[model samples]
Target: MVAFMRRRTAAALLSITGLLVLALSNPAGEWWTALQQPYQSEDLIKCAYDKCIPEGDDWFMAHLNQTIHPFLTPQSNLSAKDFLWWKKLQRDPNDLAAFKRVVDKVFQLFPEGKGFMDSGSQRCRSCSVVGNSGNLLASHNGALIDFSDCVFRMNGAPTKGYEEHVGKKTTFHIMYPESAVDLTDNRTHLMLVPFKTRDLQWLISAFTTGSIKFTYLPVKAKINANKDLVRILNPQFIKYVYEVWLRNSGGYPSTGFLGLMLAIHICDEVNVFGFGADQNGNWRHYWEELKDKTLRTGLHSGTEEYRLIQKLAAKGKINFFPGH
Candidate 1:
């Protein structure tokens, strides 16, 4: 009996020592974290694409900060501290109280009740981010783009005539006040990328009062969109994309880049189409004629954005279909 007790005591000591060693080795307590919170670890956390860290691509996981919420909820109120960085993009001068009033009015109408896409589920959501680059002209990606679980389009990218190239199905249409267009399909969610407090005000006014018509330039007073289906992009998310993803490369990320990042956050599989310049190296829309061959991105770093997109494709984070 004495011998057996001694052996048990020795085994307990060995186990304690092993645990101590593990604690020292993992100072961040990552192993313990993984065990306690399964699938929350960077290695185990699956994106909407149904994968965590892609093989041979540590850069993506390293840069991807999951703490950022990409959309504004009714509870997501921007404090004065957060507004300091957020206001820099569009030089918004509105105070915190003024911003809150606009936001309150917005939620009153939109009422982000629940069932947002941020919540993870067993079902895998695939997405196709369609840009308006001229490269999509000849490429017959319409069928493929529409087949995705979600299709994201930006600005005034019309799909009536170019359905053969650019898909007819638009799950989400992203735009600011200046670029806002009336959505004929009530099924499509109108995602407003609010650059300033005015943008939020515009969203409310466009749907109701139609009083706030002008920003830096004249914007549409009223927009025909489904009030229930309207969504607003979080301003903090824009700052995150600027600092973390783009590394403050451009003045700010373009609408297309923001839309792509949104897909990455919410979808299991992301497929990109209609980005970058065309074969002739002209930066023109697929539907429009090349009036100016020298046309290029002014505010945003188009070149740097394209480079990052290429790197993402090369790293296998996204399957890029560079339309011909």
Candidate 2:
């Protein structure tokens, strides 16, 4: 009887040790930082390397068509009917042939699947959508943000001096033709949120013949990003976010809002930070100093978007850390 008890105690000790090792190896960071807190979406991001999805665009478009159709439209069909929708989005495909040329050129520039496509026992895939809100200034969420499976940063939110608050890791950087900036590393994926066909034309030109430079806003003739790591947003997806999600409340959707929706589609669980306004009710970026008292979320309905974000969080679709 004594020998049996000794063996059972040893087994229990080993089990306890294994649990401790698992917890330390895959730390859940912000979601379960406290002992009593329940596990959240951010808790699922494992530390293993991300698996790249083969022929990613085909996979994404296939999924989008089935579920997020019309809203999540891709280049499944660049026909006249699709061009009409693009025209409605202010793309102005005045000539069908010219529009086809633009679409063909864009198709050539589109990159294959690069990250988080695998769905095996190893896939946990938690994502963090880091906005440029002033609330992140002193939040010191850098460690927490970096712990995510992927971090999506938008609109030139720098991390050099602000590493303590925003974290230095960026798995994906989302931008538009006008908002594009030179990336410091090849590891982060560069996702172009093209607003119009000219934006797609600009991307092809920047990487190929280098003819187009100025758009509605002047842009760089060339950008620094790995060609293989680049991805472009479907214009249909943008329109979908505008009409279906935002319910056509604003002239267009903000890049941050669109970025969040993209994360919702790709990530298993998403954690949002540095979004919305700051404590003083100033609608400004964390990097900015001057305050605009009359600042509004240009062309995007800021009030409704905030409300929607709140609703998503309440519904357990996301964990929103409104630091301010």
Candidate 3:
């Protein structure tokens, strides 16, 4: 009888040990710890727009998935299968060797590329995702956008003279080789969204060799930006945005949408600006005149994406400011 009791106790201890090991290894362990502790006002997780509820909170838990890491660090590993899947998005050639070479060079230049901006303290980190929609024209949301802790802008959206309509404060600029532009501000981080191996290669070449000037079309040979503040988005995160968030809509998520997701993951409170069409229902950028009023979102499912944005807004997940 004593031997039987001892064996049962040993099994119970082993189970507890396994549980402890899992909690330490997984990032969700923080949430588990939060669940155990008494609900204190200071201990509550504060997000950009709302304070997360203590128990049975579906909204906060659903958005915060620790498994899906959004950025690529030097230690990140990409399997051949995942690489092949990512390359197919842009129909890039099947050249894993070439891609690895570029990736290696990129990490060598930017060693500290992993992780994202997170407020470790009780302060709520707010983020503003500013798109290039024509609705931003005359919207006068410049001051409102600059109020956030971090501002994310995409592509060739210029803010030189349109400071009143679109804020001058650009914390992070998201772009690819095709939409590349010179970032005059040293404080801004150049976040490159690589769609192909050549895109990664171009990032290296732009800063160092200036050898690559074309990718399906003419690209900038050299870009004037701070290399130390450079960041590359994880391909796995792109897949997550496409499969989970977008539900495999369009060719892929637009840069603006990607910026919005990035903000959702990082910021406690998120404010979206300069999305959708102008009052005239024309899809054009705020900086340019309406040359193609009939033009629609190509490659990306703009209509569906906007619909999802509206749903998220209705759910109070994000504050969506539809520009006039």
In terms of TM-score, the best-performing candidate is: 1
Clashing pairs in 1: 48-267, 48-268, 49-267, 49-268, 49-269, 50-268
lDDT, each prediction: 0.78, 0.69, 0.77
Off by over 4 Å in 2: 1-66, 69-75, 78-82, 88-97, 113-122
Q: After TM-score superposition, what is the CA distance of residue 139 in candidate 1 from its true location, in Å?
A: 0.3
1-324 per-residue lDDT for model 2 (tens digits): 224224433643664465456568766643223321223555443423343222234423433332442221224445565456666655554566776577666666665443454445455566789999899988977766765668999968898888778977888899887888878877778888766678778888887887888886688898888887777766667767776778788887888888888887776557899888899888888887845578778878888888878867765566798988
What would the per-residue lDDT of candidate 3 be over residues 67-186, giving only the tens digit for each residue? 767787766677777788799988898577777777888888875665465445454556789999999988887756765567899999998788777877888899999999999988
The estimated TM-scores of all candidates read: 0.81, 0.75, 0.80
**Per-residue lDDT for 1-324 in model 1, tens only?**
224224433643654466457678887755333222211233322233324214345788777767777788878867677788777778899888888888888898895833445545444455789998999998987756765667899998999878768868888999999999999987789999998999998898998889988999999999998888888898888888888889999789999999998888877667899889999888878888988777798788888888888998887677799888
**Model 2, residue 216: C-alpha shift (Å):** 1.3
- Error at 157, model 2, angstroms: 1.3
Off by over 4 Å in 1: 1-56, 77-79, 113-121
Once superposed on the true structure, which residue ranges of model 3 sit more than 4 Å away at CA? 1-64, 119-121
**C-alpha RMSD of each candidate structure in angstroms:** 16.4, 10.1, 15.5
Candidate 3 lands at a TM-score of: 0.80
Error of 2 at 109 (Å): 4.0
Instruction: Sort the predicted structures by TM-score, highest score first.
Output: 1, 3, 2
